[model samples]
Target: MGVRYLFQIGDQIVYPMHGAGIIESIEDKEIQGKVHQYYVLQLPNKMQVMLPVGKIKNFSIRKVVDTLTLENVLHLFHNGETDRTLNFKERYKSNMEKMKTGKIQEGAEVLRDLMRMNKEKTLNSSEKSMLGNARKFLSSELGLINGITEDQAIDLLNYRIGK
Candidate 1:
């Protein structure tokens, strides 16, 4: 199975679109006479979010990246650039989808692309928001993995990206 049940109780994980949360417990419950297994999650940053087990994959929840992987993801921001789009709505939708996918590497791509486009011209509101979200998400995960504050992680990433 792609989903691992080995996430320790109380360990923090990133659910990409949902940001950071802790795995509260693994529970076996019955719903409509069916036995359901779940990885109960408590979102520390979000209010009253208790996630069920079977839906974790559908929810895009995964363990946070390791320090080495986080380093490589930061390095990606300086490597490749994406083609800019003329349609603001389309670009926003595409970048939002990427951000929701829970792949740090892809988030780096969106960040790099948006920054490049921003330098060429001022971004529309949607694009600007997406850029901010991508940067925040990446930095938050980096913070969790590196044991640093979110602002520190963002500063380190910006310095590495030479932004």
Candidate 2:
């Protein structure tokens, strides 16, 4: 028997490390002689992914945040502070783990901390790439939730974080 998916076609979901996307379809495919259910997601960046329904829980796939949660995520910028004393490797690892959570608030923290770090000192190439990924992921979700363009979402985040 194939695993059932909680999400239906047209539902909006956030795939950690991949950003937000709409569920384009659910299909059954035979792999290794066994039939499995998959969710076909179309990302905002025009990327598509096929995720096995049985592995959904392991991936942290989730629905988009509601307006109130979005508000709280925005407010995190005002209340959160980055600890600059931590070593670069340690900070990067921590931020990467947070990004993997697929939570809007966690993504906000990663972006905020990285932005602050950038102002204090130049980041290494890995840090710069992580910053870009976090920003893109956050902006994608923000755009979907607020009905704004990705560029507009980036602008709003920049304004909120005082960039």
TM-score of every model? Answer: 0.78, 0.93
Q: Rate the local accuracy (lDDT) of all candidates.
A: 0.75, 0.89
Candidate 2 C-alpha lDDT tens digits along 1-163? 9545689899989999989988999989999999988999998878899999888889999999888998888887778877878898889899999999998889889988888888888999999999999999998998898888788988987886788
Worst 10 residues of 2 by lDDT: 2-11
On a 0 to 100 scale, what is the lDDT of residue 75 in model 2?
A: 83
- How far off is residue 2 in model 2, in Å? 12
Candidate 1 C-alpha lDDT tens digits along 1-163: 5556656687888877656666777877888999887777665444435566667667777788787887777766677767654477777778888888888888888888888888889988878888888777777777777777778978977887767
Assess the local accuracy of residue 101 in candidate 2 as a C-alpha lDDT between 0 and 100: 96
Best by lDDT: 2
